[model samples]
Every structure is written in structure tokens, then in C-alpha cells.
Target: MSEIKKIHMGPAKCAVDLGDGSERGEYVNQDYILNKLGRPHRAVSLMYCYYPLDETWPARARNAFKDKEITFQWDYPYDDYFTYKGGIGGTTDDEPFTCMRDVRRHGQDVILTMTIDPNVTDEHLEQIGKELSTFGRMQLRINHEATGNWFSFTKRATYQQVADFYIHAREVIKKFAPNVQTILCIGGVEHPEKGGEIEMEKEFADAVRATDIWSVDKYMALHWGWPFDVADEGGNSFGRSKVADTYNLTKLSEKRYRELCGGVKKPMVMSEFNADGDVTGPYEQAEMVKEFCDMLKNDKDQGWFNGFTFYQFRDRGRLGLEIEDPNNADCGIEQPVMQTYKEIIHDEYFYPEMKSEGDAQFPVKLRWGGSEDAEGIEIPLHFEKNPTFCEITFEDEDADLNLMMEINGKWFYKAPHAKTIDFMSAFFEKPLESEADMTLKIFAPPASGENVNDGSEDWMLNTYSTITKMPNIRIRFAPILK
Candidate 1:
């Protein structure tokens, strides 16, 4: 007998991502999610390149990303390209907002991120505040990774200067957008000595007061092509070629955050995270995904921690879950990490919106029959009444468990195929006619050759008998009583 372990399904949490928005029609595919995966993400994140605030730039941003569903907008407007009124004005690669009309119409909230300039004028801050006031709410993040040397703000602006700017921006935005919140995004504590040796409290004394949420950006880059030290960039450490041996990236980040920014007790999130495919293959990346989620759930400060935003949806330079192919816009090849991520976020913990409110429980038992070699079982859903909503939760020891439902003489296979499944739900517009006739089957994970899609159900036809152990399962149903 194997040890019975319970998978803790935590409370509702936010799970977000940055999808591909390279072109108009080249956005992330919804058809694949609806028809294939049968799920929708909680929120979507978009990226906007550097652009100074010209009169027309806001209109371009509004036109490009007017979708009310966008939860976060990443931007890179720096001191070099920005001024009080307007600097070098042209079209940015992408913009978060173009006009305030769409924002007013939808009353939608935006998670806006951008770098602050040391030379920014009060007029510039006022313009930004005024623009944000027209929206439902805003989470404005200024000068992310101020401790990192990549951005000009790190070198040009002192910590006090950055903090002063942050406080000023918050005050200006609050006057107009009362519902707006400010976020203080920092690079991970791992490289705290990157830009300077100053402590966060003394340096960011004023900025901490203005911040509503705290965020950090971390990545698994030790074993990647990156050298241990920035001074050794041209060294032979380029081909470390192995996935990181440690699974405590999240744990380390949280610990370091508490050590450095412990005084500021605010909500924290991993604003950006990923294991580069260029650094590690899909399998290793998939492993890291699970590890990171586990650490977030078990180790981090749950009260102060919210959730994370994955860097990219499709493979873009070194990051992304799905393989990027410009020719195939629908959805590129599913990297192993893609399916792994889909399954992990499918948990109700990530999508609290899907959590059911009903208290009905439908007893189900796996009926094992036939010869001792039988690989499948007929699970009978002994429902006393018709159900308006039904969901099944089960824990499989291996990835070999496959589930199917027979409705109206047709069979539907639950997706995230061949992967270990945690739970699945079914909702009917109308009450079920007869619960006795409805049946479900479980079989060994299918083992078909690659590129063997015949466009028919013949591929799913399997008849092997190897009954080993009874799977741990739970069922819940909300029935409509006439």
C-alpha cells in the first residue's frame, strides 16, 4: 500500500501572465484555451516600450491596449527619453494608454509600471496623475529594480531622489485617482549589493511610506550562461549548461526580502519570474515551475504575499512557456512547461472565481471489474437527484490516469492529457436528465506515437487490463430541485 498524501488546495489567489502582443492578430490564442483547455486565465499583462508623454501618445496607448481585462501594463520610459512636457516624441514600441475615454467608459483598473527620471518636472508628474485619475484605479510602479545597474535611474538617481519621486508621484496620483495604489518594485535581495551598499530603510525612507505593495523581480540564472559576477562577463562561464540544482529560489527571495525590507509590512508579489528555456530545457523549467509554486504556497508570507506574473506566454528571447514560431500564430508547440503551468494554475487556489458555493456532495466509487488484467474502471456517480453543477477531485499517483465523461452518447476527454490530474468540473445549462445513465471511465495514460493524429477518436481507443490501486477521489455536486 502506498502512503496517502493530501494535496492542500489553498484559498483563492491571483495568477497572471504576459501574453504575446506582437501584432494585432498575433495575440495569445483564446480558441486553444476554450476548445482545448476549457479554461480562462484570471488576468492578462501587457508590455509597453519607452515613450515620452506627448499629446498623441496616450491616444496610441488607448488604441493599442484598451482591453479592460488587462491587469498589468509594463512600460520603460526613462530619463533619457522623457521630460516635463515632452521630449523626443514618436511612437513607442507599445503604450499602456493612449486616451482616457476607454478608461472612463469601463472604469477598469490598470497595473501600470514605469521607470522614473531624476529630472522629471512637477508638470510631468501632474500630467501622469491627471491621466491616471480618469481610470477606475491604478497600481503605479516607479523605477523597478532601483538597486540594479541596468536602468539609468540606478546610476544617475540617488536613493533619496528615487524615494522622493515615488512619494511625489503617489501624492499627485492620489489627488485625482483616489483609488490608485502605489507599488515599490525592487530587484531581488540576492544581488542587493549590485548598485550600492546602502540600506533600504535609510535610502528609501520616504518611498516606503508611499508604497501600498512591495514587489521583487527574480530569475534562475546562476546555472545559465550568466557568470557568477558581472565583472566576469567575458569569462568562460558562458556554458554552465545545467539546470539550477537548488529549488529554493522563491524561498531565498522571500527570506532576503524580509531581511532587507522587513520594516515595510506590505503586500508582496513576484512581479517577474521565469526559468529561461535557453538556460534550461522545457523539462527543467517545468520542474522549477512546480517548485516555485510550492514555495509560494508553503514558505512565503501568505498574508503579505499575493501572487506572481510569469514573464512571457510564448518564447521570446530566453523566456516564455510555449515555443515561439512566427509562422504559427494560433499557439506554438506546447513546451513541457506549458502543460505543467496549465495544470498548476488550474487549481482553485489560483482561480478563486471558479470555487463552487454549493454544499451538495455526490458519492462516487471506482467499480473495478472484468479480468485481473483490466486497466480501466467504471466510476459510478450515485447521484440521488439531477445536478446543475458537478465536479470531481482526485489525486493520481502517476501520470497514467486518464479520465473521460459520456454525455448524450458522446465522450469528452479531460484535457492536460497524459498529465497527473488534480480535479475537474462540469456545469450544465439545464439540469441533468438522468444521473444513472451518465458514466465515466479511467484508463492508463495513452501511449501513441508522435504525429499520429488521424482526426478520429480511434487514437483514444485502448483496451489494456492492469488494475493496480484504487485512486483517491472526491465528488461534489450542486443539484437543482424542482
Candidate 2:
């Protein structure tokens, strides 16, 4: 047998767009992947169009997704672009904020596609910076695919204006949330004439200074062919360029980013990646994913590539890892690529164990149900040493959900919601000053909007009743300061 190449470098982590963050789609697919498929991706991706007029456009996105379903005047007038100063604080009412917090609580990162108008002001950037400051490390991709014809931002703003907005936004956010990495995402280099005719180097030159990562949203369209006919063309479904190399196009984009940034190296990410299933099938997509992973592992600049977020987990067509079942998104029929991808990601190179630098993460599943659960379940926490600071996180739990925790029968802590509520340090200083073992009485009260008047006494029948529904509940302890 030819010598098997020793796998050296690969993505430190991987993510997937669980699909439709605005609705229950992401939660459904996330549950399916974690509970059914058993994929251990450390991050989740979602998109947001920063339309400030409705005030509830992004906030109440969970209401509906279809354009036709929207009851309010949703579109933001391009010429009358205004600063979105709302949601500065991490309000539980904010869907995106809660989702991001939930992902972080579950020991996963978030990739937010915060599509915005190019006319954002310094004040607006500062507001966003403050909002992001409360969040953990996240990849914030603003105005993705600006060089493409799809996004509205590109149509309204010039190339230079786009670059300027990125530069300013990055500069402002860096002051507050340095952990939030601004990603300069663009289209692939396969067919420059198709949408991105402007030289990327010239286009993104000014923004490079602020960009923490370079990214390209590429699909193996050459091999699979476009799913839809090219718009403005008379039923032309063919790709614009003769070249049909997906891997080469990705490399070319990376090369351009490197050259454009004046040889300064920055981590590259495949922000949105998938192979269309119009021509072949999941097998072709599987091959594409395998080839992409192999390329990253074998490349001379191995670790230079950070990671990739799969285009989707469940969508309308075979474009996703599974064909979405309209009635039940979580119960979609798994595509062949799903199995292949699972095997690939389970490899040591692709799925490295992640740890916080200065924080120790302890995962605990707390489920309350039986009649005995009324008095609350006492869960014991064992720490190697006394933790100076601590934060408890509940995954996807309602914001108004209350959890009562009585520590050692001396200190009592009631968690109002899932957001960061620091109570452990106070308890840590009290009776458990030196003790490493502490007992916590965990119980959930009737949620905020629950119909207590029904008087069924089946209090636990609410959201937090089952472990499967709220799996990833964790307690993170920060290291003592020097």
C-alpha cells in the first residue's frame, strides 16, 4: 500500500447553519443533530437582516419567515437608511441575543450574519459594540456576499462605501468586544464575471485592516451545475465561466486575500459551503465535503484555515444535509452526505477537544418531572478548588423561567432567566469558602406567561420538563484572579 499521508493540520472546529434562526427551524435541526445524528459541531450559524423600522423584524423573527407571511411593512427604504440603536443591552426579548447566549451556554460558538445598511453611523456602531460586548467569542459577518447580486446592500452601496462601513464597524466594535471577530465574507472566485467582476483586492483593500478573518461562500456548482437558471438570461442554467474547479476557486480566493492584505496572514473561513444536488446527489456533495476537508488537512499552510460552516442542516431541497420534512423539520430523511460528514468530523483532526483558556466548563443535565421534583432536585457540584466566579447557563430555556438554587441551605439564588446571572461568587465567599463540594436545589416555577389559573398542578409540564428539550445546561467557573 502507498504510504498513508499522516494527517497533520485541520479545522480546529466546525459549525452548521441549523437553518432559519428566526423560527423553530434552528432549534428543531439542532435537536436532531445533537440527539439523533450525534454530530458534535461546536458552533451554529444564523442570518439577520438589520431592518430597523419594524423594531420587531429581527426581534420577532420567530413569528414567521416567508416574505408573503409578513403582515408589517418589512422592507427598509434604502435612501432613508437609519441607525439601529435598539437592543443595545442583551435583552432576553431579543431573539438573536438569546440564541447567541444559548449557543454559548451549550459550549458552542455563534456565527451571525448581521446584514446591515451601508449608511450605519458611528453611534450605531458603538451601540452594536456595546451589545456584542456582553456576548462570548463570535464570528460576526456583516453584509456577506456584497460583491454578489443577491444581497441588497451591494445594489445600494458602492464598493468603496461597503469597504468604509466594514472598516468603521470593525474599528468601533473592537473597542468594546474584541472577542467578536469581524469576517470579511465574499463570493467564490470560480466565475468572477458572474457577479464579482470587481477585483477583490481593489474592492476590500481598505477593509482588510479591520477584518479579523477572510471568508468565501462557495459551492461546487461547476460539478453539480446551478439549481436555477441565471436571472436576466434566457433560461441559461450554465455557469458563466468555463472553469469548473471548486477547490481551485477556494484557493484562489484565499490567495487573493493574502495578496490583498499585503502578505499579512489572517485565518480564512468557508462561511457558507455546499454542493448543489441538482445534477448528481448527496454522494457528489459528500465527495466535495471530503475533498474540501482533505485540502485543508494536506495544505502546506494547514492551520491557516480556521473552519467552515455547512450551508445548512435541513432545507427545502436536497441542498441541505437532509431534505426538510414540512410537517417535521427534525424528522427529515438523512442524506448520504450526513453519514459521510459525521465520519469525517469525528476524525481527531476535524473535532479537537475545545477548552476555555481561563474558565472551567462543567456540563450538567437537570430535568424536573416526578412528584418528588416539586420539592426540587438537589444536584451536587464538585470543583477541584474554590472557584472565584461562576455563571449558570440553561440552553433554550424561556427567559422568564425561574430556577431556585439553595446552596448548603445557607445561601439562596434564584435565576431569573438564561442570561448571565452571577451568583456563585457570593455563595463561594460564604459557607462554601473552602469547601469544593456544594449542593444546589434546582426547581423550576411556573413560567412567566403560563396559565396558572388552570390549576392542573402539572407545573413541570412546561418547557423545562424534559432533558431532551433543554440538554446542554452548563455551569462555567472562572479562574481566580492573580
Candidate 3:
């Protein structure tokens, strides 16, 4: 079998849920994401099964990303009332089959998470294993905690039972998706009843031993109507000042899991994470995102972390999605947090220019309309081809005295002994010609040191200036003395 590829650091993308029932519209379309962010995301998670609600789920997903490049992770039906009720008789058999067919047909990739509920019997899991073996591209989702009607073996059953379930799941996953791309384990939820207070570190560690990829989810109470400050309590704080919550949680979880795996050679995906309480403004939200990214980028050790996927692309009503305040028009589209994120993601810088060995100089005359007190001034300077010393001499000494030479953006005074004054000794590289219309701004600054402190004094500095599309500009290189 070919080796499984590992993902390191990169941009944090997003995963969106395309609602349920007839009202289920495209929650977050690919085009919308691309346009808003400028580039296609690395991965996107699709919630819900493709059975009845979305018979054409694969087609819709494919069309949404027809010409773009993205990784699509399908969250197969959870062992729950919503999925089981909508699916054909709550059977796991046809679900995997249909999902695989869709994956193959649509030419899309998927991270298939198997059910870990008690209702799913050993026989059912075996079937899932067989199907995974048949399916080419897939990932397994392991549950560290119970969900929906599912009960955790860690709670009621013995440790052996928990280990058995994981061993079986692993064997089956290897039989089919043997590359074992991803493994997502449940972290914790807001509510306490759903396997509340149960720590499955040992259980998760055992599972990771048999898989190549690993991840976890921290369903914060903030999304479910809890106060923002509540996160601050119990080491979970969503406050603007406590922006490290998301990063700390994910990092801590991954660190433990890596330790459990004896070295953490796998990437940690924040399977699910979203903001809660008083929907943060764009700028605040952007900072929160930056916190998550900056921590990963700055982490000196460990190479298993790939990237993060924002729990959602848009706000889902069930999650109590709230705008800061409608009347607070300032919180709208130009939200500070959103703008901040946009800037961070689209930041561009000029490429550095390569410095050559020998010195080079090129000089040319420049002219422009005079402003305020300045008038037409002539500047004559002989630049050394590669010499370490040179100076300028103008035919009209009076005109030259009334003018000054500006190199780059700094101004220099004219000396009586032009030949004695070495110009090349000051410059690091050969000076090039300034572009046209570039203002040298040959004026005078208010005298302060060594001169009278009045604007009436004449500095008489003729500044040569020009503007060009080139990266650097200089005027001392022209009129090379051969």
C-alpha cells in the first residue's frame, strides 16, 4: 500500500453545514467562499447524509465546486434521530455504499466517519469496515465520547470493551481505507448529560495508535446561548481579551494525543470550533482567527499540525447566530474584525531586489513645473562609473548655488570644493535615473541648527526628481565622467 501523506501548516479554511429539510439551502457555496476570501479553501465539511434530503447531494457539491480545487469531507449520518429517521430505515449498509458511489462519481474526496453509537452493533461495524475497504478515498471518525442516543463504552462497559471497539474499527478501516488519512475523536460538548465530565485520553490514545491522522472537537457553550464570559470560566473564555481559548484548547488536545501516540507524527485538525455569545464583531473575530494561526506558526516544535477549519462558514440559526447589534451600523459589513482578517489573508509584499557585484551609474536630466517659491533650476553632476569618489560642477555657479541635489529622497547641500567632496563614498550601490514627473521638492526647511530659525532664509537647494515604476530610484548616476 502507498504511504499516507501528512499535512503540516497552511491557511485555516472553513466547514459549513447545508441545513436540513426542504428549507435546506446552500449554507455556504464554494463561489461565495472563493470570492470573499480570494482563493479556494483547502477543505470543506458537508453536514448531513445524502439520502432523502439530498438525493443529488454529490451532484450539487460537485457543481458548487466544478472548476475549483478543494477537499470535501462528508460527515456521514450520525447515529441520531434526525439522520436515522430521514435515512432509509436507519440502516448503515446503504449509507456507506451511497456515499462511496457519490465520492467515486463526483470525483471528490471524503473523510468518512463511522458511527460509534451503541445502536451500531459489532456486525454493523464489520459491514462498515468492508465498505471502507471497498471505498478508495475515506477517513474514519472515532468517538471518544457518546453522542445523540449513543453511549460510550468508557462509561458503562469495561476498558476492554472500549479497546475492542477501537481495535475492530481500526482493522476494518485498514481493510478498506488502509492509508488511514484522518481520525476525528469527540472532545467535549457544552451540555453535561452527553457523556458529561468523561475524559477519554487513554481511549483516544489507543485509537490513534492504529491510525495515521487524528483530530478532536470542542463544542463550546458559547454557540449554544451561554454568556461570552462563561468561556472564561472553567478555562474556556471567548472574551476578546482572552483570545487564546481556541488556540490553547486545540493545542493542548493535540499535544496530549501526540504524546499518547508516542511522538505525534500526525496532524491535528480542529474538527469543529466556532464562536459563542454576542456574535463577535468582524475585527474581533478576525483577531480570534489570527490567534489560532499565529500560535501554530510560532510553535517551534512538533510537525503534525496541519491547519484549522472554522466550524462554520455562516451562522446557523440553531447555534444562536447573532449579529453584534443591528442598530450599531458600525458592526455591519465593514466590521473591524472582518476587515482585519481580510487584510491578514490578503497581505502582499514587494519582492527584494538582487544586488549586483560592481557599481553602475546612469544619469539623465529631469524637469517639472515649479511650485510656490521654487523656480526652474539646473543640476549638473558627474557620477563615477564604478569609482569610490566623484562630484558635480554646474556651468552657472549662481544657479547651482540657488539649487540643491536630492538623491533618493534625502537632500544634500552643495559644497564650494565640488571635486574635493567625494559623493560615491556615501552610496552603497550605483545610482539609477529618476523617473519623469517625480518631484525632487527643491525647497527649504525652517532653519533650526547652525542657521537662523526662520522660514525666510534661502536654502537654495536644486532637487532633481523623477518617478518611475522601477523599485529603486537615484539621480547621482547620470552624466558619467568617462
- Model 2 TM-score on a 0 to 1 scale: 0.61
* Tens digit per residue, CA lDDT, model 3, 1-482: 01111111112322221111111212333333433443222334444322233443323343543465432122123221123221223454443344333322221234544334433454544544544443333445554333222332334445545555666656654653343454646562232344332245454446656656656654332423232123334453333335455455556666666666677467666655544434453344555656655555566764546544444444322221223234542221223433444444443210111112222122222221111112222222333343333443343322222223333322344332232223343344324343222222222211110112134322111222221111122434345678
Clashing pairs in 2: none
Q: What residue runs in model 3 are displaced by over 4 Å at the alpha carbon?
A: 1-32, 48-108, 113-115, 126-136, 144-163, 186-198, 219-221, 225-241, 277-283, 302-304, 318-482
Give the candidate number with the greatest lDDT. Answer: 2
Q: Give the alpha-carbon lDDT of every model.
A: 0.45, 0.53, 0.37
Q: Which candidate do you rate higher for lDDT, 1 or 3? A: 1
Best by TM-score: 2
- Candidate 1: tens digits of C-alpha lDDT, residues 1-482: 12222111123465443333321223354334333333433333433323343333433343544553332122222222222222233222223443111111111124555665556566666666655543333466677766555564665567677777777767875775554577777544443336422336566645654578767765654223222223134554323222232233433444545545555556666666677655556677778777767665664445556767666666534466666566765546667877777667766556423112222122222211111111333443555455544444344443343333222222234332344332333433234465544344442222211112245432222122233444444444554466
Q: Give a tens-digit lDDT track for model 2, residues 1-482.
A: 11111111113443333333322134343323553334335467776666543444433332433343322222223211122234433343455665564444333456777777676566667777766654545668888776765455776678778877888878887786665778888764656556433256576766754588888877664222222332233444423221136666766677767766678888777887766554336677677777777776676765456677776777555567777687865567778887777667666666633221221122323332211123234444665555555555555543444554434332222334454444454444243545476544444433331212244443213223222232232444565467
What's the TM-score of each model vs. the native? 0.54, 0.61, 0.45
* Model 2 lDDT, full chain set: 0.53
Ranking by lDDT: 2, 1, 3
What's the lDDT for residue 263 in model 1? 54
The local distance difference test score of model 1 is 0.45
Quote the positional error of residue 348 for candidate 3 in Å: 9.8
